[model samples]
Target: MSPTRSTRALRAVDAPQSTLSAAAGELIDADPLFVRERTAASELPDPAPLVSNLARSVVEVISGVRDIEQLSRWVTDDVYRHLLIRTQHAARARQARRRPTRRPNFVELSVRIQATTENIVDAVVVLDFGARVRAVTVRLEGLDRRWRASAIHVL
Candidate 1:
């Protein structure tokens, strides 16, 4: 073949190979699982609202509400179990003390987020309940696009 014809043939061959390679790369990048994995690893939702709601729910539970069903929506099974046991014990203690169990009378609540990861967060919540201050540490995890409390420590 003539030099020009040979050059033209080479160019045509290389063009298709380059296009095929680029297409392969694009296909890999567009894979559903790969996209989902990347998004799941990189995406982190704001935790302020979640922490506030969870804190309020915990306070309500401690204040003789005993709404485990509603609390389940925002907490993990372990946390729910913990809350159930603790609330029951507190109720019994109050009965033993001959005092009627009632909701906490709090002036204000202050929430401080300690650490945040892609799917986990640690926070401290303080409630100014009339006579004294109550503080609790809460750890939350993101599951199925919603935040739920994984653990709680009352202080």
Candidate 2:
């Protein structure tokens, strides 16, 4: 990110702690299951990539796809080569048989991020299949001033 954008995030993190007049935030904030850090809504970083990439990987796998390269690009290290081998094999087998293997359903998502000083982000995403949890992945990465994904995991 540009220096200006970096400054904006810094200012947000350093805001005075006394101001308390604001309307409700996103609709999800009202849910009993919602837990948030950085008391101010302004502090929440955009999680779309984390959410989207996560959903895409699960959906791609369960759909019996052989296009591991695409999903591999989003992963860190050998998750594509080592960790995901069984999944890829299964997908390829299902495809060869011309039968559907499974479908992806997002079970839950949780993230813990710290936005001041140096940024740290950790994410956990779960995908379900019918009554069973099909996959669970954990991701950890640091953002530069730009807050881009630097590393991702399938753990």
Candidate 3:
């Protein structure tokens, strides 16, 4: 039709506020030092792979086989600092024992995942280290359309 008709039709339509726009409002220089994005669970990928990979990488980091910096993008600042502290302790223990740094021989046995909320998942990754079994628990939160480890513990 006519331009006037189209303009009138558009004017008659009511538009609603977008969730994306609403979410973006929180990012407007509220805190210049720390800024993080929240993503909907449906917009994220499966957490299983990230959980498994992070578990393995964390073990390697503690064993001095991997650098903690490699995981910085996939974890929160608190988790990064915690992992760094653990890595330091492991390195010190190794130094005390005069053990040379080597990659740990391990196999991922299984992963158990539970969703605590739309944007959060708690998972346990079981690893077999030949002579022993260990479990790594990770809490993943959806951020910026991806998974970031908010908490991690090895036992």
Point to the candidate with the largest lDDT.
Answer: 3
For candidate 2, the lDDT comes to 0.50
> lDDT per residue, candidate 1, 60-154, as tens digits?
78767657688888787788898999888888988889998676667547889865666677898887877889887889776666667889877
State the C-alpha lDDT per candidate: 0.75, 0.50, 0.90
Write model 3 residue lDDT over 27-143, tens digit each, in one string. 655766556687866789888989999999999999999999999999998999999999999999999999999999999999999999989999999999999999999999998
Ranking by TM-score: 3, 1, 2
lDDT tens digits by residue: candidate 2, 18-91? 43212233444676554333222144456546645655564566465435566654554444555366576766
Mark the regions of model 1 whose C-alpha exceeds 4 Å error after superposition: 1-45
What candidate 2 gets wrong by more than 4 Å, as runs, is 1-45, 92-99, 105-119, 143-155
Candidate with the greatest TM-score versus the true structure: 3
Q: List the residue pairs that clash in candidate 1.
A: none
Residue 138, candidate 1: alpha-carbon lDDT: 88
Q: What is the lDDT of candidate 3?
A: 0.90
> What TM-score against the true fold does each predicted structure earn?
0.67, 0.43, 0.78
